[model samples]
Target: MPMVPLLICDDSNMVRKQLLRALPSGWGVSVTMAANGMQALEAIRQGLGHVVLLDLTMPEMDGYQVLAAIRAQGLSAKVIVISGDVQAEAVRRVLELGALAFLKKPTDPQALHKVLLDQGLLDPSQQTVAVSRAVAEPVTSFQDAFRETINVAMGRAAALLARVLGVFVQLPLPNVSFLEVGELHMALADAQGNAQLTAVCQGYIGGGIAGEALLLFHGSEIADMAQLMQRNSADYSDMEMLLDLSTILIGACLSGIAEQIDVVFSQGHPQVLGMQAGIDELIRVNQTRWKKTLAVEISYSLEGHNIHFDLLLLFTEDSVERLSRKLAYLMS
Candidate 1:
């Protein structure tokens, strides 16, 4: 069978190139690129490409909107979403909207190749894993090791969400960093942007490691979430779904991290921070309590919807020393 035309879409120049560059040599597919949802939609509408390698989080148009448009127009393109939006709801939403496959961002060459093979988009005899620099080299750096560890945990969280929502979750690049709370907003400026936002803060502590997991949702995306949760967009329904989404994503994420480090976190009740346009203004918590925090941020986007969110697993200063030692153990 002839390989189908592939359109790689993402806002990041590196990611777009990574997807295109990682393709196997002599693969019979034609390739193209799109930087945003609008551009992706236009490309598909104009028959520029049929098989899309889509990114979920983008300005103007996101993967969710592009998937929605593809479904609305009944496009015949086989869309495979390759993004970092690992939320379970996001995965299920896109497949429902007609995605052929869902792969995580900075996707594995083996995984990408497998999707193509299974979809009959490539001849299996000629398809082989294309090893790229993007592959994890855990022992090379402490950060890389932790990223891999969290990447494993992120997959566990995604699997849980997939089971519950009956959808495939897009695994995102887990951001492992050391920063002060005041510095976090700038670090995540692109993900948060100027969109109105809502957040769920859950505190976790165990084995001398303690911190908060903050799940931030786009305010305008609440209605889409309500619909995904199969509930009316009433105030009560919204709150209920918000709580439900928080419990699953946060719980699974924290649990995955603890399981890897061989520790357990006693979680506190999730606090809803409500909605506001200004992310800094919307958060009511004091940042100065901790001089620095270990921030593990995952930017999540729901496929086939106009929503993108972040799951920030923030560890306190005192806990970092202990957490570092524990994380170091994995590298041994």
Candidate 2:
């Protein structure tokens, strides 16, 4: 029997490795892994991908563009999208672009096997073997594991927001970095660029993990946000709207993360960090909070609307070791 040409494409090394570990042991397949859409396309063009397992949120190029490109060039690769972006619109778009199936992140091995067999991509005889639980590869870094964790949480938060607002939420690749206080300020400044903002901060701590979650909104977009929420601008104060949004997004996002890492966070009361202020002003006020920290930044926008917001999860420097240990347990 010939080995099936299987390709797994995802931006996170942890997730790619997870997929590899989920494959049926009895199925004969030569696996190829791509870290991004560009590499996935290059491998496909070189005839390395007969069955492509793809991810949606990625740098350089995303899975959506890859699907479109595959269709345009008439590639025979059958794509099964494995993504953390589980929004209805995301699923619809990928299916329309020619993905064979859409599986949520942290994919179940039995579910994946079923999809392969149902799609006739796997032989029926392979079903005799149960899925493997062995960790086939080491996670490349703590950052990859942490970012993939937040990616799933980010999708949950977005899905909740979308359901409440009756609008599709556009998700970005969650950026994870460890930086000094000064570098953190510069990064935030570059992202906001002097725009007036309303922001809230809430702290969470439990089981040796502690961090602050900051939700930032552009002041100019408040009116559009009010319109979407069906609240009259004159009746609802801007502060009220900002706090409401922060509670929904920050609370949901943090809860999602805690669920995945097997911890519960007792959250501090949400505090208004700044209203109609610049990024520098906000950072200056809170500069003494930490010397260096791990920051996970995610931006979300409402489809067909002018509403946008950014969520930042800042874990203290001392918490990195705890986080790495927790991630190791989860991956195991």
TM-score of each: 0.55, 0.89
Query: lDDT per model, in order?
Result: 0.71, 0.85
- Candidate 1 residue pairs in backbone clash: 64-304, 84-172, 90-302
Candidate 2: lDDT of 331? 60
The superposed Cα distance between candidate 2 and the true structure at residue 248, in angstroms, equals 0.8
lDDT of each residue in 1-332, candidate 1, tens digit only: 44556678876655665576667664666666777888888888888677888887667877888888887888878888876556666777779888888887557888988898889777766545332332232223456556655665676777676677555555466778888666765654544464476677778899998877778888798887777666754566676688899999889888877877889889988777534333454333536535687778787654455667788887778887786688664444
Evaluate residue 161 in candidate 1 and report its C-alpha lDDT on the 0 to 100 scale. Answer: 68
Q: Give the number of the best model, judged by TM-score.
A: 2
lDDT per residue, candidate 2, 1-332, as tens digits? Answer: 77677889998888888888888888777788898999999999988899999999888999999999999999889999998888888899999999999999889999999999889999888656554333246466788889899999999888888887889998999999988998887777765664567678887898888877888888899888877777765768767877787888898998889888889988987877644455566576667765798999998998898778889998877778888888995566
